[model samples]
Target: MRPIPHPGRPGKLLRLLAEKYPTKEAVMSRLIYLQGQLVLPKGVEHFMSDLHGEYAAFYHILNNCSGVIREKVDYVFGARMSKEEKAEFCTLIYYPKEKIEQMTAARRATPAWYRENIARCLALARLMSWKYPASRLPGLIPARLRPVLVELLATRPEADAAQLAYQQRLLASIVQADAGAEFLEDFASLVKRLAVAEFHFVGDFFDRGGRPDAILDRVMALPEVDIEWGNHDVLWMGAALGSPACIATVVRNSLRYDNVDVLERGYGISLRPLVTFAQHLYPDEAPIRAAERAATILLFKVEGALIERNPDLGMANRRLLHCIDFRNVCAVLPSGRYELRKAYFPTIDEDAVDPYVLTLEEREILDGLVTSFTESPSLRRHVDFLYRKGSLYLVRNGNLLFHGCVPLTEDGAFCEITYDGKKYAGRAWLDFCDQMARAAYLYHEQEALDFMYFLWCGRLSPLSGREVRTFERTFLADKTTWEEPADPYYRLLDDEETCERVLKEFGLSPKKGHIINGHVPVKVKKGESPVKAGGRAIIIDGGFCKAYHEKTGISGFTLISNSRGLRLLAHQKIADVRTALADNGDIESVSETVELATIHTTVGDTDKGRAMQEEITDLYNLLLAYQNGVLKPQA
Candidate 1:
C-alpha cells in the first residue's frame, strides 16, 4: 500500500498525537484510524457520523496529521474514503513499487480512504488535547464545587485537591451522610480551644427566644461563664413562684403570645430547676434567690418576645433583681407585702452596728479618715485635705475617686465639726449622709422599686453646699432647723459624700492614680464643657440598667492605667438603648421643658436647664407627630 500523505506535517502531527493521547489504548485507536484499518459498525451510523465528530476528525485530526502520510497518500490517491475491496486489501499490507506507482496514478483519478481517516484522527486528537479534567464531563458543573473541594481538602488530614474532590463526589453519592454531625463536632472543638476572659450576655437568655432551657444548659455546662442577671431570667423565676401579680404583670407583658395558662405552667415547671441551678452556682448569695423570684414576677408582667427585643428593659430587670435584704424589707415596713415606697435609710440600732462585720480594709480606711480629721483644724481645710489636698487625697489622681461626693453645705463647703479634738467634716459630720448612702445601696439592691419611684416621683438629690451646712448646724446645735431653710437644690447631690466616707473607711484610695466610682454617675469630660463638669470622675454606670439614651451606646468604660498615663476607654460602638426601654413596657411620657425644668430643679440646681430644654423640644416634636398620626406608637 502507498504510504499515507501527512495531513499537515509529519513531525507536528506525531507530536500532537503523542501529547493528545499518552495512554496505549487512546494512541492505538488513533493510529489504527489513521491507517484506514477501522470501520464504522452497522447500526451505529448516528454515533459515528455525528457533525461534532466529523468536525473533530476532519478539521482538527487530519489537519494536524504527519506530513509523510500526507505526501504519500496525496501522491497515490487524492483525499477520500475508499468503498472498494481493493482499498480494504491495501490497508492490510504494504504495496510494491509497481502498485504504489499505479496507486499514485489512480489517486489522481479517485481519492483514497486512508487520507480521510488520518484527517479524522488528527481532528479527534486536537479535541482531546484541549480537554481538561473538569472539561471531560458532558454538562456544566456548578461553580460552588471548586470551593467545596478546597474546604474538603483543608479539613482532611492528608488529602490534596484531587483526592478531596474525588472523595467529596464519592461521599455525595452516598445516601444519608452525617454532614451536620461532623460539622458540629468540628465547631465544638474550635470553641473549646478559644479562651475567653468573661462572657457578658445581654439578655434574652431565657423564655423569649426558643430553647431557653437549652441556652441555660449550655451556660451551666460551661463552668467559667458568669451571667449578669437579665430580666427574662428574673421573670421566669418569678413565674415559677406562682405569684399571680408577678406573673400577670411582668411575665405576661414579656410573652409573645397571650397564653396565660401555658406561661404559668412553664414557669411552674421551670422554677424549681432554675432555682436549683442558681443555688448550685451561688449558694452563699441570697440575691440570686431574690432575683429568681423577681424574674417570675417580671415574666407575668412582660412577654418573652417583647422583652427579647428590648435589651434596656432586660438590663434594668437584671440589675433590679437582687436578693431581698432585711433592710429592704424594713424600708417597706410590712415584710410580706410589696409596696412602692420612697427609699430611706433604715434607722440603724446601736446593736445592729456590729464591729466584727466591718472588714479589716474598711476599719483601716475609717481610721485614716478620722486621723486626718483630727489633725486638720478648719472644716474647709479638712474637707479639702481629705478630698483634695491630704497626703492620702480623697480624689485619687484626679479620679474624684471618693466613695461619694460630699453634700455641700449652705456655705458652699462640706459640713464640718470638731468632735473629740478631731475635725469631722463633709458627709461624716452628719448622720443623714450615712442614711442617704444606705438608701442608695438599698436602691441599688432593688432596682425595680427604685426605678418605679424615680418614674413616679424623682431621684433623690445628692447633698449640696446648702444641706451640708444645715446638717452641720443640726449636728452642732442638736437641732434639725436652720435660720434660712435648707435649699431643696441640695437634694440633687449624689451619694458622693458617702462614697468618699466608705472609701476612707475601707482604706481604698486612688493608689494607682485614678478612680472608678459606682454610687453616682457623674458626667465627666476631659475639657470643661457647658454640658459636663471637667474632672477625672469616670462614671462607669451610664445608667445602663436603669436609664438609657437613644443617641448614645451602652454607657460603660474600661480604665487602663500605665506609666505613660491613664486612658479613659469607652465602647467603640453604642448599643440601641431605646429598644430595651420599649421592650419592658417602661415607656414614659415625654416631659416638656417646663416639666423637665421642674424635674431638674427638684433633683439639684437648674444647671441642666438648657439640656432639658433641647430634650423637651425633641419630645414636643415627637408628640406633635404622634398627635398628627405621622408616627405610630412602637410596641
Candidate 2:
C-alpha cells in the first residue's frame, strides 16, 4: 500500500512489498541497495588503512578489497598521493617481503661463471707478486732493471746462497751474450743499490716468444706493480672472462703462432692458477673477484713501448702478444731476483700510411728479405759488406732514427707526392699504404696489385696495361729524381718535416735526443753512401730482413749511446729462429698447415706447399687493382 516503504526497508516492509509487487525491477533495486551498503563500508576501511598504515598494511587492504573497487580506488588515491607514498605503495604491492629476501640472497651468491673468472684473476696476481717484487715499489728502481729482476726471480725463487751465486753467474752470462754495451752491468748495479724500493712493470712483461707461463711467473712475483689495458691485454682478459669475441680473437692469434696445443693447454693451465687464487683470496665474492683476477692476468701481458720501435717485430709478434694478453692462459709467479730496467723507444711522426697498400706481395718481398739474411749463418759476418757493397747505409742515433730520406729544405717539407701513381698524398697516401700492409698480412689477393702499383707508380692508379706503363714511367721518374737530386731531395724533406711535426704534436722536441728508424735497405756494395741526402734523419734498415750476397738470415742494427758520441752498432742476425722454435714442438704442425691454408685461400690461390709460390704473382695484381679502386669491395 504505501509502496511497502520500499523493498529494501525492514523485514516486515520487505514481506509486505513482496506481496504487493514481486516484480524483477523491485527485487533488483533492493539487491542494489544491499550491495552498496556492503561496498561502502569496505571501501572506507581500505582507504583508512592505505593512508595510515605503512606500505605493508596498505597493500594487504588493497588485496582484500574487491577488484572493481580496488581499481577505482587506486586511481583516486594516486591522484592525491605524494611521490614517496606512491613509491611505498608500489613496493608493497609489487615486491613482497618473501620475494625481496630471496632476491637479496641470490645476488649475494656469486654465479658459477663469475667464480671461475675470479680464480683466473688471482692466479695472475700471484704470479706478479712472486716474480716481480720490485714492481710493487714504484719509482725506486729504474725501468731497465725490472725485466732483469723478472728473469732472475723466474729462474730462482728460494734466494738460497748457492742460488744467489748462480744468479750472479747467470747475470754475467746474460751480459756477455747481450750485444748491448755495459748497460747490463750498470743496470745490475742500480738494481742492487735500489733494492729497497719495489719495482713494477706497468705493461707487457710477458708473452710472444716461448715459455709464456715461465715469463708470467717471473713478472707476477713483483709486489708493487700494477697493470693497465693494452689492446692485446684486453683481448686476453675478455677471453678469460668467456667473451665470445675474445675467444674468436684467441683462435685467430693462435694461427699466427702455429701453437694450437699451447693455446689450449695454456688457456686451461692459466685458468687453473686464477681459480686457485680466487678461491684462496676471495672466497666470498667469487665472481667479482674472478673478474679482477682475470683482469690482473691481462695486465701482466701488456706489450712494452719497445714494440712500437720495431715495426717489423711488432707486426710479426702482434698476434702472439695479443693471444698472450687476451686469450692465452699463461700464468706467472713472482720470484724476487734481479731488478729490470725499462726500455724506452723514441716516437717518430711519419705520415700515417694506409695499411691496405702494403699487399701480400710487398709483405712477401719484405719477409723474403728478412728470411734470406737471417737464415744464412755467414750473413752476420758479412753485414758490413751488405751495407758498403750493396748500396745500403746504416744511420742512427741514441733516441730516434729512420731509414728513409730526410727533407733537404724546409720549403719542400709538407709537400705531397703520388705514392702509387694515385692522385693523393699526405694522409691519404699513408692511410692507403697502411691499408695495403694490413691486407698483405691478412693474405688478401689484391695485396699484390697494390704492391706493384705502389712500387711502379708514385701513387695508386687504375689497373690496366696502358696504365701500368704510365705508372712505371712515373716510378722511374721519381726514382731518378731521388737518385740524381743534387741540391735538395724531396723525400728526405718530406720525411724530416713529418718527423718534426709528429714530435712537436706529441710534446717531444727533436733536440731532446737522437731518433733511430729503419725502413729503406742500405747499399752493401757502396761504402758509407748517404742514405738521406740532406735531412737530420738517419737510416738503419741496412737490408736486415732482405737477402744480401746470397745470404739467408735476419739482420738488425742496434743503437747504443751514453755519454759518448752516437755510434751505430754492428748489424746482427739470428738464423732460422722461427723454424727452429716452431719445429721443436713449440708450435703444432697442424696449426701451421691451417695458417698456410688460410693464407692460400685469402690470396685466391688453390694450392698446397709447392704451388704456394705462384700465389705471389696473383697477390701482386690484386693489390694494384685494389689501390686503383678497380677492386669491387675496394679492399
Each model's backbone clash number: 92, 153
Query: TM-score for every candidate vs. truth?
Result: 0.23, 0.24
Error (Å) of candidate 2 at residue 236 is 27
Error of 2 at 498 (Å): 8.6
Over 1-635, each residue of candidate 2 has an lDDT whose tens digit, in order, gives 01111122234533344444344444444434333332211101000100100122212212212122223324545566565543333232222233224334657323332222222212222332321223343343346655644455445425587875765565555535541123322332233222211221111211233233333433244332222212233233333332322333343344333333334353332223334434544455454344343322232122222223323221222212222111122311121121112111011112323211233432343233233323333322222221222111111111232222222234543334443345443334334543543343234243332242222112121111011121112112223222222213324333555555533432346434333434333454454422232233444433332334223121333222212123332233222322222221111100000001111111111112113333323333333333344432211
RMSD of 1: 36.2
Candidate 2 has an lDDT of 0.29
Q: What TM-score does candidate 2 reach?
A: 0.24
Model 1 / residue 288 / CA error / Å: 30
Residue-wise lDDT of candidate 1 within 451-565, one digit each (tens)?
Answer: 2222111112222112222112212222332243333223323334433433444344422222333333323333211111122233333222213223233233333322223
What is the lDDT for 342 in model 1?
23
Error of 1 at 371 (Å): 57
- The residue-level lDDT of candidate 1 at 112 comes to 31
Poorest 10 consecutive residues by lDDT, candidate 1: 42-51
